[model samples]
Target: MSLKYAPKYRVFLFLIFCIIKACDVLFIAYMIKLMLNLASSGSKDVTELIKLATIAGIGQLFFTCSNFFYEHLKMTIIKNVNLVLKNANLNYLVAQAKNDTKSGLSLMTNDLKQIETGRVTAQLDMCYQSILFIGAISFAFINSWQMTVIFIVASIAPALVQILTSRLITRKAKVWANANADYTQHVSDSLNGAEAAKLYNVQPTIISRAVNSAQRMEEALRSMNFTQAWALEVIYTVAELFCFIIPCTIGGVLMMHGQLKVGTLVLMVDLAMNFITPVVTIFQEFNQVKSTDPMWKKTLRALNYSKNPHEKAIDQRDDFIDLKIDNLAYKTNKTNTEIFKDVNFSVTPGKKTLLMAPSGWGKTTLLKLMMGSKSPSKGQILINDQNLTNDWSKLHNYFSYVNQKPFMFDDTLRFNITLGRKVSDQKLRQVIHEAGLDELVKEKGLDSPIGENGNQLSGGQIQRVEIARALLSHRPILLADEATSALDPHLSLEIHETLLKNPNIAVIEVAHKISPAEKAMFDQIIHLNQTPTD
Candidate 1:
């Protein structure tokens, strides 16, 4: 899977390296055979040995140089392939409307590691081993065809072992991959909930669950490793019995009968081992590559998803005349129960509307649908009298969202507020003032770092930063979902005033609880139960 992403020229270069390696092996074997022949001939001159040693030394040097380039090319290809895969994985996660960080982490880390070793490296090894096997067999056949035939016949056992265990190895690999992902999720959950667990005195429960997940993960890994090892062991045992012992015994008998020269018999035995080793190795590599089927399929799916049409250019606008929902409805897939039914609403430029609904009435869900983070089960959302598509990339452009918990990356305040967009300092300052974030800017400056999820800022200040983001975006509609619920009364009123005072921006805030005075600031208020308030 990853090999396809490797540069074509680099792959060609690597294949050339494999051929050179095979040639080097054959040359070394030939040198050894010549040395054995010299010894068998009862040569007395030390000069001939010296000459052979000099020639073999030069060959060894050339082989070492070829090996260095070979290893360098292998790593280069692996690096290039991994880069492509990681980028595709990142784009896929970012393109999602609601991404699971834990799942993404698992994919990028655990699954990717498996694909690297089991699929990419294994495939490359098979190529190298196959070429080397061909060269060795050719050498052996040149020396003694009868010995080569015996070696080939005996090699069938290793191939059979690989075929029989391929499915079992793949199953084990898949189980290990799944268990690894589960363990990652559990560890993340345990850490994220550590504070709550401590407060509730449930540390023991959390520890127990984490331990159980870890144990399961290790057990799966053990199973996978043991299966792979056992397969290799069987292959090795078969190779030793059939290719090594049988061929060496037959070569000795042939030599005793003078059917083969002493030097030739020794060379055939060495060549037999050479070809046999590659046969076993190729089978091992094939099984390893097969084990990554599940992970490779998952990676391919993500790559395809990242290249989806929806990920292409989408509509971007700074203003909308009106946003309306007509007979908007949503229901749960599991229970077929409506979270909200026949919901109707509309917003025009500069109009401030408050949406009131009791808890469990799907106010947040309705906001999600309007913001395009979720799709409606029925009806359509119209913008400027044109129906909107289900594509969030296009639908989300006309609105800015401020929910109860605004997400923030670990970055500078400026980047967090503007989201890495190129914004003029003048415009930035104006929005910061409008959002009542002037005090924070005055104290910390825009370049100050905001910790992850804005933990560096107070609840009220984080809400103000969210407002600053919304205002800076110049999005016409502000969809605030319990945006001030986390703040105190004073800060809530202040946030509400800042949100409502923007005459050019329409505001649609949904909340079940708000001070009456704060609620009265809206130009119009509508209840989810079809009630209206002045």
Candidate 2:
């Protein structure tokens, strides 16, 4: 049930796992013997037999407790792995390293989930139960090895059927993994853009996609379930028929020659009954255990996603000065669709700079690179001649960025403004005033729940809210990406004044609003020409 990606715990846990399984098999065999003896013509020692049974039960109890404790410990390990993954900024890391969201998501979700399913508890439980069954077979062999051989020979039929059917289980599990991803994508697409889907008459399309996702998931699950059930039934029917066939044929032959006692005959019948459950259980759970390999494989596939700088190396704060780029180049893909080549620029402290580019000239790409996203394919971005991209903590802490489409969390004005941080209420008032959020706050107090992504607020209100959140960071250097595009002239003028005359603020606005006085706001400009499509 464990994956190839079994954490370093494997070196120790494997041995413990085996010991726990061995204990269970021993316990089950003792119980089987006790039951057979009870049904035999023996009486006065019933109390002794029950006492032995109690001891067996107690021993099993100890193993069961150990099973749970170790399982819980394993869960802790998994959670620790999650923390490591989260700290590693696995999303950004995987995006940069694997460069594929689908594969990354699979590794994070389906792969991790499957790893959980391969719980050491479940695996050990099955393995131990199988061990008990084989123990019963061992008991039968002691009494009559020839009959045991016949029993095992009959077992081969089920094994053959299982081997042939295992391929189907694997195929279905794969389909299930794909279906799960599709369903998640559908849910994300629909929920993230519910308002747009509704307004643009695309709700039906989203619904159709959702349905397809769900149907695919259902179909895959159904196929797996049906195949498993069919396989089990075939094995069970054959097993049940042979259970009678073996004992009856062997017992009758012995009785005809007067070679067996009634007690031995009765014991054989009891042995056959005892053997049926465990043997079938072994076969069935073995298939389940086998199926788990793929699940673990899927999970490990995600956990094993390649990454660089496996740990956080920098958290620089409050030391940022000039934002300088040196011979930077970046590509969009492996085939060298270079977005920027040898681009160099600097925005000094308390100085404003403009980055202008015609459509499709990698303007946004450059902006993203500066903001700790979309890393450059070549060269570096520096703060005080030391790399900012290498350690964006100072750059991040000292600067605030505004994207073209602002994001809003579904929370109160207080939470939206402070983002769950401990900021003085007085600062909130200033941010609301500076960002001109007074009207929104006045209409509904700070406690008001903003609808999902600020859908209830206008574009301007959402932008202001995002700005208010940024102000809470107190970043000295601010970058705006067409942030004021939704605002009217009057509001734009007020925002421009705040950026320009704000005593000690270094602000760079990616302006789309071309006002008469706009040129004076920025100290430098880099005009970028449009790219000609080939």
Enumerate residue pairs that collide in model 2: 107-302, 111-299
Q: Worst 10-residue stretch by lDDT in candidate 2?
A: 307-316
lDDT of 2 by residue, 275-301 (tens): 666666666766665555655554444
Give the number of the best model, judged by TM-score. Answer: 1
- What's the TM-score of each model vs. the native? 0.93, 0.72
Model 2: C-alpha RMSD to truth?
5.7
Clashing pairs in 1: none
